[model samples]
Target: MNLLFLGDVVGRAGRDAVLAHLPELRRRLATDFVVVNGENAAGGFGITEKIARDFFDAGVDCITTGNHVWDQKELVGAIDRETRILRPLNFPEGTPGRGAAVFQAPRGRRVLVANVMGRLFMDPLDDPFAAVGHVLRQVRLGAGAGAGNGVDAVIVDVHAEATSEKMAMGHFCDGRASLVVGTHSHVPTADLQILPGGTAYQSDAGMCGDYDSVIGMKKEVSIARFVRKLPTERMTPAENEATVCGVFVRTDDRTGLGVRAEPVRIGGRLAPHLPEA
Candidate 1:
C-alpha cells in the first residue's frame, strides 16, 4: 500500500496547489491512502469544517492537526462528528475528536492512522511516547476488547517542533509502525530513509504553501514581527507561486514494512521533484 503524507497547508495558495495537483500526483504514484496535515490550512490556523470538507473532497482520506487544531472555534463541534479529522493524541484525556482510527483504503485494506504531539519546544502535553503506546494498543485491539480489526498497517504523524525529539520517535516506533513522519516544522528535512527496522522516517515533511515566504507566512510581516519584537499582525499567505511538499512512502501490505520513501516538492520556489511523464 502507498501512503502519501502532506505537510501543513498554509492558505489559499496551499489549498489551490492541492486542488490542482493532488489528483495527478495520486494517479502517478498509485496512492492507496493520503493523509494531509491541515493545522494551518485555514489562514495558517486551526482548520474549519468547510476547509476540512474541501480537503476531503480533494481526495485526502484523513486530516491531522497539531497545536493549532483549535484555532477555528467552529471545529469544537464539527470535530465531534468528523471522524476523519484527528487532533494530537497527546492532548489531555477527554479532548474532543479522536487521536487515532482504523480506516479502510480503496482496496478494502484496514489501515491505522494515529497522531501525536511532542513536548520539546512545544506546549506541554501528555507524554507522546506513552500516548503513542496507548493509541497503538487500541489500533491493535479495535473497538471491542480483543475483537481485533486485523489492521494491515499503521501510520503515525508525529507533529513536533524539535528535530531530535522527532527522530527519537522514529526509532522508538521503528518496528511497530509502517511510517513515522514528522510535522510542525514546516521545513522539509533531507534525511528521508527507511530505518533498519523497516519503518520509513523523515524529520519533517515540509509545508504545502509558498516556499519563498517565512514558513508560509507573508515574508515582510513575519520578518517585522520577529525583528521588531512587537505585536505585529500575523503574516498571511501569498497568493501567487504556490508549492506542495510531502513524503511518499510505499509499504508492504501484510507486514506493514516500508519499502520506499521519497521526498516531494512541486512548483513555487522549491525545486521540483516531479518530472514530465
Candidate 2:
C-alpha cells in the first residue's frame, strides 16, 4: 500500500497548500493512507479544530503533532473528541488525545500510526523507545500474525530536532514499522532510504510551508532574533506560495515493509520533486 506522510504544516500557507494539492496528490499517488503533522498549522504555534477538520476533509486520514500540539488552548478540549489527531505518545500520562491509533484504510487494510517525541533537545518526556515498543507489541503486522486482526502496516512519526535521535528511533523500530520519519525542523533532509530491516527511514520530512523564510517564519523577524540577539516581534508564517514537503513510501502488502521511499517537495521556493510519473 502507498502511504503518504506529510511534514509539519505551518500556519496559513501550509494549510492552504495541503488543501489545494492533497486531494489531487492522493489520487495521483494512489495512496491508501495519509498522515499529516498539523502541529504548527495555526499561526506557527498549534493546530485548531477548524484546521484539523479542513485537513480531514482534504483526504488526510491521520494528523500527528509534536511540542506545539497544545499551542491552541481550544484543542485541549477538542482533541479528546477527535481520534484521527495524535499527540506524542511520550506525553505525560492522562494527557488529552491519543499518542497512537489504528485506522482501517479505504481498501480494507488496517494501519497502525504512532507518534513519539524525542528527549534530546526536546521536552524530556517518557522514554520514546519504550513507548513505541509497547505500541508495536500490541499491533502485530502481517496476516501471519492474524487474519483480519493483524495490523497491515505501521508508520512511526518521530517528531524531534536532533538527527541522531531520529535515526536511533528509526533503527530501534527497524523491521517493526513500515516507515519511520522525523518532523519538527522545517528543513527536509535528503536521507530517504530503506533500512536493511525493511523499514524506510528519513531524518526529517521538513515543513509543509513556504521555504523562503527561516523555518516557516517571517524571514526578517527570524534573522533579527539571531543577529540582534534581542526579541523583536512575534514570528509569523511566511505568506509566500508554500510547498508540500514529505516522504512517500510504498510498503509490501505481505510484510508491511517499505519497498520504495521518495521525498516529495512541490511548489513554493523549493525545487519540485514529486513522485515519478
Candidate 3:
C-alpha cells in the first residue's frame, strides 16, 4: 500500500507545485496514501474551499474531481460538507460531493478512492461503467475471504476526455483497481503500466500546471482561441514553473493488487521521475 495519484492542478502554477513538492513527495515515496486532482485547483476552473484547505494542509489525503467540478461556485454548497472533496461519480443523484470514499491509511489500511467521470467526449454522466460497477460491488480488494473485509487499496480516478475514454477506464478497473489513473488531459502520458489485470495503469496523469502552456492554458490565450475561431480571452493558468504530474502505486499488502508502478515527473518543464524508494 503506497499509492499517490496527482495530475490536474492547473492554476497558481499548479497550486505552487503541489504545495512545493508534497512534503518531499511523502518522504520520497514511502507514501501510505495521497490522491490529488483538485479539478484544476481554483483558477483554471473549480475547486475552492480555501483551495480545499490548501490541499489538506499539503499532505493531501483525498480530493478528486472532473468536469471542472462546478467551477468554484461555492463548490455547489460547499460540496455537501466536504467528505474529503470528491465529485463526478456520475453526478445527477443530488450531485454535490462524493463520488466514493473510504480513506484511513497509515497501517490501519483501507483506501478505496474512486472519482470516475468519462462519458466519451465528456459530460454525459452516469454509466461510467455503471458508476464504476456500483462502487466495485461495494469494495473488496484483498486481505482474507477473497480479500477479507475488502478495501486495502483501489484508487481509480479516470477523469477523462477520451484517450479512448482513458484507456477504457483502465481496462475496466482490471483486477478491481489499485490505481487506474488518468485526469483531464494536461498531457503527461507515457503509459506507466502494470495492468494484466493487476491494475496500476496510466493513460494520462499529466497537468500539474505550466507545461509551456496550451494544456495548462495561457499560451497566447490558447493561441487566440485556435487562430481566431472566436472567443479570445478567458483561459488563464500557466504562471510558469510547474511540472508535477503523477502516478505511483505499490500495493499488494495481501493481494490488494498493483505490485509497483511509477511515472511521477517533478519540478518545471518535465524530464524527471521519482520511483525507487
Instruction: Give Cα-based local distance difference scores for all models.
Output: 0.86, 0.92, 0.86
TM-score of each candidate?
0.94, 0.98, 0.35
Among these predictions, the greatest lDDT belongs to 2
On a 0 to 100 scale, what is the lDDT of residue 153 in model 2?
A: 88
Candidate 2, which segments miss by more than 4 Å at Cα?
144-149
Q: Which lDDT tens digits does candidate 3 get at residues 36-133?
A: 98987889998889988988998999999899888779888988888988897888887667899887787677888888888887777778888888
* Candidate 2: worst-modelled 10 consecutive residues by lDDT: 140-149
**lDDT digits (tens) for residues 126-245 of candidate 1:** 999998887776554212222365666788999999999999999998878888999999999999999999999999999999888888888899889879999887568877778899
Q: Rank candidates, lDDT, best first.
A: 2, 1, 3
Q: Can you list the residue pairs that collide in candidate 1?
A: none
Instruction: Give the Cα error of residue 220 in candidate 1, in Å.
Output: 0.5
lDDT of 2: 0.92
